[model samples]
Target: MRGIVLFFCSLSLVACQDPAPPPVEGTVKYTNAQWWLDGDFAAGERCAQDGLLVACPAEPSLTIDLEGGFVIPGLAEAHNHNIDNNFGFTRMNPEYLKRGIYYVKNPNSVASDYQYVEEDIARPQTIDAIFSMGGVTIAGGHPEKLYVEFLSQMPAYMGRDFDSLNSDAFHLIATEADIAPTLDLLQEQGAQFVKTYLLFSEEFERRRDDEAFYGAKGLSPALHLALTQAAQARGLRVSAHVETAADFAAAVASGVDEINHLPGYFVRDVATTEEAEAKYLIPEDMANLAAEKNIAVVTTTIISTNFYQDNPEQLEMVKAMQVRNITALKEAGVFLAIGSDNYMSTAAAEAQHLVDIGALEAHEVLDFWIRSARRVIFPARKIDCLQPGCEASFVAVSEDPRLALPLPETITYRLKQGYELN
Candidate 1:
């Protein structure tokens, strides 16, 4: 009986003991590089283990010689539509990773798209993460028109009978009663945030002289306000697509969290006329109000790619206006985030545009792309800076980004989660 009792006691002691922990992933030490941290350079030798930076390793499993390259946190795409157009992800994923853009945000996409990309497709190993806002829009609003128009142009690519897909993907709020249900559906679809658009309808465009037709096509002001309140109540950030002065004012008054696209893109005759001034399209008072409200403006200046290609003079005129508009917004203390909006290759070009316009200096532009952009997309992640606790994600450029007028052409190395991508 004593021997049996001792055997049971030994079993209990063994069960109480903690199990062995899994071995740590191999340590990677990055050496001989000018590491950019907290808006300045830091010590060159930094070690990382298990996808995070740590204190200097006593014996690193692997060491990479950066050859004195400049390292900064990986870039982020604040506003993108890579999933809406099915082929975009396939083409842009590798390119985005190669260019050191590891984080991508798709502000609008269909339910099928989310499942297909997030589950079916094998994402590039280099990509750190993809954040998406499952389709949220107003009935017969901007993106609805935009998507229908695009599908009409490319019927072969987008099936002729894609109405069901659109209906399932885009949550359209036709009236006040639709707001709650739409928000619930969006949440069910795994949306991280809410996206809404304010645009003129086809009827309003045709009957331009009809005073009653204005602002009646999209969600009414009352419905917009309700939508904003409901989304906020659910703890979701709201992003609005605005181009006209009226829409911009409405979006601000409705208390949206972010405003996409700079002013003067779709205002009356702005796209067609060379004399379209930014001041007229975007009122100074409205800009000041947005700044006061702390609403961020994503500089999707690249959305003018089509207009620029058809008319060179118009391009120059628009560029000048953009420069002036951005400068004024900056003076008003408005926070600016960068987004290529389908022109992924032109990320540096967008940054350079801000520099050329004198809205921000070269180094400031880098922060706008790397730091400011991350804050907008990953607000709760707390991984914007390249500090020890942050994820080990950064890109090593051939030339120092701070001293260069534009981004360096050659990316010597790209690291995400302490793993080398290229």
Candidate 2:
């Protein structure tokens, strides 16, 4: 099954779960549509078959006049977590759909925790949530530090043991021996993708002996390659979390399907340290290699906000390095996907941050957020455009979102699979 579309009201209907089925045959017309076309807005008429776009039919039926509404493809969150907890889905999931974000990727959520919220995801009323179940990391990996920091900031879980949370969220693999077994376990847990941690992999060996660096260390190069190869052999998409430029290169060398963020985006300590700054700047050759291999890099630069809170100067330096990295990737022609891996926010924030940093203008960010993000989340699906053979899904707003700065806070309407979501 592809996903939940509204109930069939006419000639043909596909079952809810079929991802690729024979076309459904009801046509709906959207007129006076000021929609994104050829990288810019163009006034046009659009048509849809039930749950799919007929895009340019000669005689489309069931016309609905937009009366000056602006339409764009639904926005997507290519990376996010902390949306699958028992108490969080109800509180957080709707915010995506309400914001017209139709797809979300939880790259490293706990499988056991997913059982608590899976019922609400991937349904018609909910955003299409894809989960990696858990991530593959070393004995003590980066996310442990993230969890500690999260709890420290919240103060609610200050002294409590969160070992089980760590256990469920990560599959620890220290050697080649752990690769096959971990893949099997991930498949058993119904992981949508395979996530691996390459956090500062170049320093992993040295850090292994240091307790202070426990949560900062990740898979060694050999083990990282082994795990990624095994997962790819099983036809799984491998998304890697990387820190420094070395980590990015290692993840690339492992032939991972996606890199979760640019190398220097979240690094705060590098701005002042000349040697450290050099270490995080991505090389042109490496970016070119990633582009040649067709590896997608998700932009989670908004994560920089979580650091350098009191130092604007350091933050600017970090952002300057981030921009250099983004420019490198762009020049190398690497496919960039917008995502907010920041636990406290959404991809919308990431898109806005991209604009605020001058990495991209408002129109470019809006287009990328609406058009590029979904395909990154589901490369095999036809959901990127309002073109023929695409899914009949789109978000409409009262005015052009490109004309504004913070993106639209209100969505006029939503139509998914020929069904009115609003």
C-alpha TM-score for every candidate: 0.82, 0.86
* Poorest lDDT segment (10 consecutive residues) of candidate 2: 1-10
Worst 10 residues of 1 by lDDT: 1-10
Candidate 1 ranges with C-alpha deviation above 4 Å: 1-24, 120-124, 128-135, 152-157, 160-162, 200-217, 270-275, 278-281, 343-346, 356-359, 405-409
Error of 2 at 355 (Å): 0.9
Candidate 2 yields a Cα-based lDDT of 0.74
Q: In model 1, what lDDT does residue 168 have?
A: 52
lDDT of 1 by residue, 64-164 (tens): 89888888887876777643443445555666676777776667766665665664232225343444344555545545554454533442235633375
Q: Which structure among the candidates has the greatest TM-score?
A: 2
Q: Please state the error at residue 95 of candidate 2 in Å.
A: 1.5
Residue pairs with backbone overlap in model 2: 1-17, 1-18, 2-17, 2-18, 2-19
lDDT of 2 by residue, 51-79 (tens): 77775667765678887777888788888
